[model samples]
Target: MSMSVPVVGNFRQVPEVAQAGCRITERPENDLTDYAQLLDVIDVGICAVDRTLCIRSWNAFMAAHSGYGSREVIGRPLFELFPELPQDWLKERFDRVFDLGVPSFTSWEQRRYLFSFPHNCPINGGVESMQQDTRLLPIKDELGRVVQVLVCLFDVTDAVLLHHRLAETIQVLEEERQEQQQLIARLAETQEQLIQSEKLAAIGQLAAGVAHEINNPVGFVMSNFRSLEHYVEGAFTLIELFDRHIDVLPAEARAQVARLKQDMDYEFVANDVRALVAESRDGLERVKRIVSDLRDFSRVGETDWQWANVHACLDSTLNVVMNEIKYKAKVVKAYGDLPEIECMPFQLNQVFLNLLVNAAQSIRERGTITLRTRTEDDHVCIEIEDTGAGMTPEVMKRIFDPFYTTKPVGKGTGLGLSVTQSIIGRHQGSISVASTPGLGTTFTLQLPQRHTTAM
Candidate 1:
């Protein structure tokens, strides 16, 4: 019988005695060495099975890998000789080679260990079993009829282990990348908070000084206005007495007095004088109220929690930002009567100022800004709505992000909403907004009446 052998072309240490695919006839015993010697010398594990799946030939490489001698495995059924073999899978592979006359291949990635061969290479010395890359080849007879199949397996444990290690390395690098991004975000937020805190501190100092400096002048002006009002009343009474005595005067004197009174428009002057003095008094009172509001809003040294009137906070903030808003929008206040709640009034006042100023700036020319306050369950809700150029969803998403702004070059600092959010967070409050482009924007602030923790 002729044995099937693979062509070992130019293999190191292979003898050049037989050409590949050359079948040997049942010649003299000395002629067998021409084909048999090459198959026994190659390192690639080789085994042949006939149509009945009986082990027909087992080379030296197969004997070394499987630990079975050629004499023991030859002539036995391949599935019976190796009980651990995937019998059905191997049979299907064999059928394709024997029945269809086509070869098949299986990579190490698909099936790691095929024969459970013990590790032999120094590079894979630590591995408990060998990994293999296998191939099945058809063996045809002289009549071109397929009679047997040759199975070849190559050790590939080192390559598979290297691939696994590289994959694990990539996973670790991805995790590190995500962690670095998170750290950078935290650092940026901290830096923004520091800058905002310094700005607020400076403003607090300035507000305190300005309020003190203006308070004295406002106090004296109000006092002097009251005295002026009294003087105007006395002057009007004397003028009335003089008119009553005019009829008793000599005819010549009476005529002269009438001409003087007519020329002076005395009645009109008297009425207008009273109105002017009243207006002056009202103006002085407004100045005094503004100074008082400034003092209340800049109460910076008083950091401890205290009961605060919410209505007063809203009113004071309105006055503080009146110049910015009055020219842009009509302000409407719907204040709800509520009890005082514990909070840092100055910080809350800052929040109100930021929201009111932002609402005003949103308007291109003129709009209406409505401030509404109402008590909900355990909290107070302050809503500031403006009929201005509203925000798109893209802009609204990053509205409170540090250094983000929609305003023109020099008009906005971009820190208003960010600082407002920080202060509200410390107060354990929340702010939310809803808007539609070209329609308007509404910002709602919810504050707990009494926070259990200190800010």
Candidate 2:
């Protein structure tokens, strides 16, 4: 009933077995040849062994690969020929096969135990290794006995190597993607700075001319006030003399003077003169402030950082650019209270200055420029909204590229937005512009209220 033929034989009789001698039970008298032929055709390495652990059906595929022949290996103890098949493992399962006869299986790939066959797996250049996918199954006999165990092995080096390569490739791609993202962020910030700088330069040129024009009117008014003050002082002195000498005049003359004084309301004149002088002084002060702001606005100097009163800078900038906005643009200020920021104040000044002017410029003759500010987290936000010509989406996309002027060739440096962005970058801030063709454009600046130390 045993599916495995016993390994008993006189090697001299069967030429195939005789060529190599074995030392176990006799081979099956019937079907011995058929078993030998079947071993050659199975795809994987296959071998059969009896309950005694003797090689029973040695296939050409298994025998040829293992350097063992039918007669020489068949009668040998399984451990003698292949120690990779441990004695405990071989006997334990083989005893089960001989006793209860239950079939069993194994999918141990390239795992080494104390077995002759496991060690027999060849390694070129003196380094040992094994096929990665191997399985073993038992063959049952008619009496419900596992008479033989069939072992199969497969090579799986390709799959394992491929997995490692794929993981490495993915890691490299992730690094590249992160680097690309950083590059884009830096590019955007740089473009913003360039555009802002250009805008400031343009406005600075314009402010210089306007400040001069305003200062002239202020000069004449100041001179007129001084002259008026001198003449008014003389008038006061004469009135005082009359007041002092009135008792000495005749009653008639004194009475006449009294009537004149009552008609003139001398007390009112004295009180009103002081008020007029105060008002005039205040007016002159306003003129002086305007002149001073204009000077600050026209700060065409080296680019560097400074602690600046952002509000003051913006006020002066607005005043100097007033000529550009006075008649056509309705200006609104929604400013917030904030501590002065540490920055390239001149450059930042130029940035906002340009933004305000640009907002005003965006509008056609007679529009609006709304300037608003708020504290945005740790930074300040300045929003400049304009009722201007606006722009199409396509134009907006390339607006920050150098030489991308929307204004006429002679008019714009095309770097206004780019420069603004760069200034923001140096301060670790951000700027964004949004617009609708017919509606208007809004430029927003989110600036860090304080300077940051480099890590």
Candidate 3:
């Protein structure tokens, strides 16, 4: 049986329906009031409950969707018809409206649906439940006393789901942007490393060629000088023998010999020739040492580990940079007894050379550059200290960063300390610096006695 009372009247008799001019049904014997007429035709879901929580009205929209006809649910308690409802909260909401006669509202964002009605859109295929926006209206009697509450629900499923998907899309794009930035940074670092390697290779080749060419000519000249020394000595001996024999010569011959000796300054030439020859030999020896140092520094294929004296490598490096530091700083070596360490000797020589040159350039005037070494347990320590104008704290912080320079633009390439650090790292060693602005700077290197065979 249909619990909805069909409206049958002169439609003009129900003023609310007459205002909208809704036509009446044919049966005039079953009469209907204006309120019931209006509830039957509205688009929103509408239901009215009395103070006792008994359903007083269930409209056509509510009846068709809830699977409960008006006859079955109208006289029952609201929760008895729908056991899934939150009984306590719904009762409180009803009590507030019945007691105070005020309205209330809730959105689908806060609670997805109140009734769990099926969303029968063909586009969605009814996979998801309907989303709702609900409102509660207080119904009052003539003296303004609340009698019943009307519940209205609006479907808002599409808008809420669209907003959720847009937020997720934004988050995904942001993560992809951050990953691209990191890849670009890595490529830039690799490019700089390749450029530096090519520059080092070219320098090594040039140094090796110069040393080889100079060595051949120097060897022949040294041999010729030695033969000339012997010849000059024999000539001096002949002159001395003549002085002894002068007493036996004729008077005229003696006068002529004495005159010739005085005119030629024979004694002075004899003494000076020996001195000049000795000085020339010493100069040649220095040239030989310089060539040896250059060859060691610029060797290309000495990458294997070997037992080498750290002190000897330091001495060779010092000789190589002697002219640069000799005028500006006096070098003082404070050597400590240390065992031979297994290392790449050529690479370590490069480290020492860089430190010595930096110490020399630090001094504004004449100062003492000290090289100190010590053995601590299984490791070796070397310190290069200069009594020169030292670095400030800011300069010390980034001293090893590639291409970061405190020197004037053209005077430095800024890779000296950075390359020194790389070689030390390869040897399983550490380097550190300490400085004060007015006093001086010291660089300390701590190296393991031996490294593993791994490169």
* Model 3 root-mean-square deviation: 10.7
Candidate 3 per-residue lDDT, tens place, 1-455, comes to: 11112234443344442222222223344654455556777767888787888887787778877988888887789888888776887788889887887888888877778887877562333337777888877766535667677788776766656655666677788788788887787677657766876777778779889998999999999999899989889888887897888899999999998898899997897789899999999999999889988999886336778899999999999998999999999899999998999889999998998899889889998999999999998899999999988999899999998777888989877788998998899898999999999789999999889887567
Using TM-score as the measure, name the better of candidate 1 and candidate 3: 3
Q: Is candidate 1 or candidate 2 better by TM-score?
A: 1
Per-residue lDDT of 221 in model 3: 91
* Model 2 lDDT per residue over 1-455, tens place: 32432345542234333222112224455534533454466645655566667766566656665778766776667777776655676577566655664444443332432222333444332324433454445565435456565555444334444555777788999999999998997788667755665765677667767878888888888889888888888888997997888798889998898898799997898989889898988978777787777666566544556777878778877876787789879888888887778777767776877787777777777888888888867888888899988899999899876657778878887766766776678789888889999899998888887787641
Ranking by lDDT: 1, 3, 2
RMSD of each candidate relative to the true structure: 8.5, 16.7, 10.7
Clash count, predicted structure 2: 40
What's the TM-score of each model vs. the native? 0.61, 0.44, 0.63
Please provide, for model 1 over 29-106, each residue's C-alpha lDDT reduced to its tens digit, 9 standing for 90 to 100. 343354456777887787878899988778878898888998898889998878888888988899988888788999
Q: Give per-residue lDDT, candidate 2, residue 224.
A: 90
TM accuracy, model 3? 0.63
Misplaced by over 4 Å in model 3 are 1-186
For model 3, the local distance difference test gives: 0.80
